[model samples]
Target chain A: MVNHSKKSINQYAGYIYLLPGLAWIFFVFAIPIIQLIGMSIRQGPVGQEILGFDNFIFTFRDPLFIKAITNNIKLLVIVPILIILSLIFSTFLYERIKGWQIYQTIIFIPVILAVAAMGIVFSQILQLKGLLNETLRVLRLNFLIQDWLGNQGLALGSVVGVIVWKELGFGTILFLARLMSVDKELYEAARIDGASGFQLMIHITIPQLIHIIEFYAVLLIVTAFSFVFDYILILTNGGPNNQTIVGEFFVYKYGFIYNRFNIASSVAIVYLLVGIVLMILRYQIVKRIDS
Target chain B: MKKIALSRIMKQIIMITMVVIALVPIYYVFVTMFKSPDEYLFNKWGLPLELSLENFKRLMEGETIFRWLINSLIISGFSVLISILVASMMGFAIARFDFPGKSALFVAVTSLLVLSPAVLVIPLFKSMVKLGLINTYYSAIIIYTGIMLPISTYLLTNFFKSIHNDIIDAALIDGCSLFQIYYRIMIPLSMPAIVTAALTNWLYVWNEILIGLIFLQSDKMRTLMPGLSLFKGKYTTNIPLTMAGVAVAIIPTFVIYLMGQRYFVKGLTEGAVK
Candidate 1:
């Protein structure tokens, strides 16, 4: 009876510790999110009454909305490219390539810098007569020079290029770290079986790092969907003519710029749903890894 | 042996090219910041005829960069501290206790770990407006704390669980209250994790432009990122000046990253890897 009472008391005390943080999350995150759902389903300035799914219907028909989703989907191509580049670079570093130490440090620099700031820098570099074009000219590759961020047809591609450049370092370092932690015995065992370098990586390194790769892929997907806002907002402002407008930018434009909060809320709801699905997938992966 | 040596050389060449690609823009920014505007137009990829601090001077004198920097410092600093404190407390509760609904709460928080708060911007904006926190430091700080809590708490909880329970039991037997055990034992023991969480939150809040841009709408209230971004628009013609602003904005993160590279790497990979 005495032990039982002490255990019960401990259970209640836990709530005290959880209270302040939960309260902040409740008020600041939860309440606002609830409002988001409410606003998504309503109409007009007052944001009262059920308007059914009209806002969502309009959003579906909106061409800009389609453009935004398409642009985000288009950005998905970066994930594979990122993974491949990271694997290659990390493998090189793992083999202790020349100057690997300096290379590792320099690469991660971009990952830590502000996306908005780097976006601005890239904006200048991608301009019609900017440093990139100048460098191309100097190298006698003037044929490759174009308005990297200006031409609507090429603007999104330019944005992708910039994202790749900035993000490559993160994956490389992450993979390298994981690779370092991997058992050297595994590789040695493979080598004794007459496995070539490529074969060793294909069978052993890839399998050993599969879980982190999956986690990173999901992260990159979430990033493509939402985190590219800074890049888009800075690099193109979704422009030359809305060619690079993405889901997050769509929400921001409709909500803040256009004052179409209902439509914005609807778009946000759609994105939120997609994000929740990904998060659930990620949660399961993390749970499996943890267990 | 010859083939292996050749492949090694090929790998070295590719990596060197990648390193150059990575460093060029940063190099260009630093180089441009030291050049005169006219010098930048004429010498886009070369050293200036003579180095000039004029652009930096103009950025400092002509804009509110310092004010924005200070605002960013206050917002990120306070938000990181408060979130860490709140997260450590919550982590302790979750790690040390066995209450009903505990698993549910942990799942919810973990699910949110991968969910960026960008989608919540619209409703969050309305809430901020309703609360009349639209232009204050509290606006960004509060939202940032909430945004960071799930991950912070998650990291701390995992760390707290690693700490042996004997320590806690001893504290309990010695009559140290629950809160006393937390503050006296848990806090001191979890400094590395707390620092990791703090650095992660600081990086997010500092680099965050969307929430800060929307929440802190006024000119004097803007954080460094939004300020620098908007400044980029108005001053597009002056490449050197824009580069100067970029250089200044990148400095704090660069300094912190250099100082705590290990912590930064640890914090980021801790989430994805075991």
Candidate 2:
């Protein structure tokens, strides 16, 4: 009975120890999210307002808002495909082949570089007078060369390509790590049962990676909105007439550059809502998968 | 023998192709950084026409590159240090002690794993302004600590839980205080996770652009990412100089990872496995 009481007291002390971290998160994170939602509903000017839903109404009615949503949707589609490709690449490299470490190191280099640097390098490569165009011209394939980052239709795609190049390394590393943890006995058993290479991957490896895939999918989507700053700012500046405008960039432009705080706040609220919903969905999916 | 030779050849080919594709842009950056404006334009994809240090000279002479580099190091270093210290403590308490609201706290921190900092930027900015922390290094460090703490804590908690409780109990019985056990026993035992968390958070803080751009307006206070943008503006057409700036920013992280590759790989895979 005395030992049980001591155990309970220690457990209670554990909760006390957690207070500082809890308080820090609540102040720095949770409160701000609440503030964003509150500010979105309240409105006056850049620093003053108490109007309700007007900001949301104004933001939704704006044409750029629609464009940002659509562009984000396009990214949502493109990034997952790239992630799948990365998974395929990771699996190929995970075969305990010779020089696998060297491959992993090389692939991960791009992930270490700053995004601003990537933007500048990719911009130069995709320039009208850039190396990519030069290569195409040399190959007598000038038709394949267009102003990759200049054309409105292709600008977002160009940014997406750079993003894929930059991110594929990290994704490959992550998936490869997860893949290594999977028991090799499963693969050997499948082989003993006469399963082919393709069949083993489809039947054993892919299903096992489903939880990780879902986790990474949600991570990529959230990052797609938050982390595209370097791409937008450096590559196109959300331009050739807002063709590459994403919601996060929209918030930045309005809030920082144009001083449209009310509208930016509303947009942020919308973004937060979308992020929360997607995350909850991912959580549910992962929970179901785990069980 | 023929099949073995073929397999060896196949592996070489695939590895080489992947390496070349990966290294092309990096090579482009390094090669251009050593070339003059004329060479950069003429031999855009080739070796430098004539080796020159003019771009690097100009970059150093004209800009606050060194200052930004120092600022980035300070911010990343301090932010990562504080985050690890605080996160490890929180993690230890949660893992070792069965406490009320432990599950709730765990869920709260874990949920933050999915919360994007982008969505929080505006409100955070407002909060910073209200706190009179705008345009200050303190703001950046504080915000970074907050952002990183949750995930690091979560990772460390997972790591700490994996450690045998019997060892901790032994230490306690042997007259080690709670803090002593945490510092001497728990932390040393969990070094791999701690190192990995520190490295990951360091990279995030170093490569971070969004918060730095918003919170830091002065040229001297700007980190590498924002500073690199200024390099772009000045050398708008000069690929080589821009690449040099990029090279400078990338080398430290690369070297660090290489030096600690064994621990880095082990930590990442171990932490991620669960």
Candidate 3:
């Protein structure tokens, strides 16, 4: 009876300990999620109405929104590219290439800088008179000196290239971390069985990395959904006629820039819905893959 | 055997090429920070004849980067402190005691990981504005603590579990009250984990831009990342000055990264265990 009383007291103390954190989460996260619904339903010029899905209707109907979604899908193409690239490079590091540690350290330097800073410098380098074109000119190959970010078709591609460059090493490091845990005996056993390195990689290494790949892919998807905002904002500002627009940036453009607060809120809701669905799908697929 | 030898050489080349691709822009950022405008315009490729700090001088003289840096330090510092306190307490609660709703609370917190500041941008902004928190250091600091809390708690909870329960049980028998055990026993015992969480928080709150962009729109309130970005627009033609801002923005982070990179990779990749 005394022990039961003491256990209850500890439980009570536990609730007391959770109070501050729960309160903060409630105020900051819970309230905002609720407020998002309020903001989305608001309509009229300054979102004066209290009860319509007009903004939601308009958000879906907007052509820019459509373009942004497609552009986001296009950007996700980089995820598979990143994963494949990361897997290949991490395999080399796993085999202990000469100076692999130095290469690993050097490769992650780009990952530390703000995308904004990286974008600004990349812009300077890709300018018509910038190093890229200038180097081309000096090589007596002026034909390659076309407007990189200035050209409409090329602007999105250029921004994507910079994103891939800055991001590639992070995925590589993640895969390397995964590689460290794999038992070495498996590799030796495969080798003793006359398995070629290529076949060993195919049958053993890649399968062992399924969970990390799933985890990495979810991160890439979230990045696709949200992080592209900053990259697009800095590098192109959704420019060369909005060809590079993505959902998060579109929300920023409308919410803060255009002051379409209701519309922005609507877009954010749609974005999170997509994210939750993607997460659910990823979870289901990865469980099956893992099992 | 021959194929294996050839592939080894090819792998080395690819790795070397990756290193070069990763580093050239960073190298260029430093290189361009020294060039004279005439050299910037005419000679875009080669190293400067004489290295110059003039661009940094002019930038320091002209921009509000100092103010931005101070602002970031203040906000990130405050956020880190508050997040650690809240997370540690909550982690202790969840880790040590059998509480009602403990599983539900854990699930809720875990789910919150998927909801980044990006998803919350619009409502969060409008709510901050409604509360008259726009343009205040307190605004960003408070929001940062809340946004970062889930991850901080997740890490701390996992860490606190690794602490043997007997330590707490022994402390209790020795007449250490729960609060005393937390402050005196738990925190000191979990120093490495706390430091990892703190370092991870610093990397995030120091580097977050979108919240700063919205809440701290005025120049005096701007943080380093956005300031550097806008500095490029303001000095588009002046390569040295612009690059100086980029260098300033990245230098401290670079130093911190060098010092605490292991914690960062471990803390960031920490979720893989679950």
Best by DockQ: 1
Better of 1 and 3 by DockQ: 1
Q: What is the C-alpha lDDT of each candidate?
A: 0.86, 0.79, 0.81
* Model 2: per-residue Cα lDDT over B1-274, one tens digit each: 6966786687677667767767888888878888877776567778886678887788789668888898899999999998888788789888888756777777668667666676788888988899998878899998999899877897899889889878877776787767787889999999888888998888888888878889998877888888887678777876677888888888887898888775655544445435
- Native-referenced Cα lDDT, model 3: 0.81
Separately for all candidates shown, the number of backbone clashes (residues 3 or more apart, or on different chains) is 0, 3, 0
For residue A47, give model 3's deviation from the true position in Å: 3.9
Question: Is candidate 1 or 2 superior in DockQ?
Answer: 1
- Model 1 C-alpha lDDT per residue in residues A1-291, reported as the tens digit of each score: 124656888888899999998898788667767888877776743355657787777788889999999999999989999999999999989989989999999888888889888889898888887778888998999899999999999999999999899889889888998899899999988888889888987998999999889878987888888788999999999998999999989888888998878778788888888878887888877777777
* Over 4 Å off, model 1: A1-5, A44-50
For each candidate, give the TM-score of chain B.
Answer: 0.97, 0.92, 0.95
Higher-lDDT candidate of 2 and 3: 3
CA RMSD per model (angstroms): 1.9, 2.8, 2.4
lDDT of 2 at A49: 64
Query: Native-contact fraction for each model?
Result: 0.74, 0.52, 0.58
i-RMS values of the candidates, in order? 2.1, 2.7, 2.9
Can you give the lDDT of residue B66 in candidate 1? Answer: 85
Name the docking class for model 1: medium
Error (Å) of candidate 3 at residue A15 is: 1.6
Worst 10 residues of 1 chain B by lDDT: B109-118
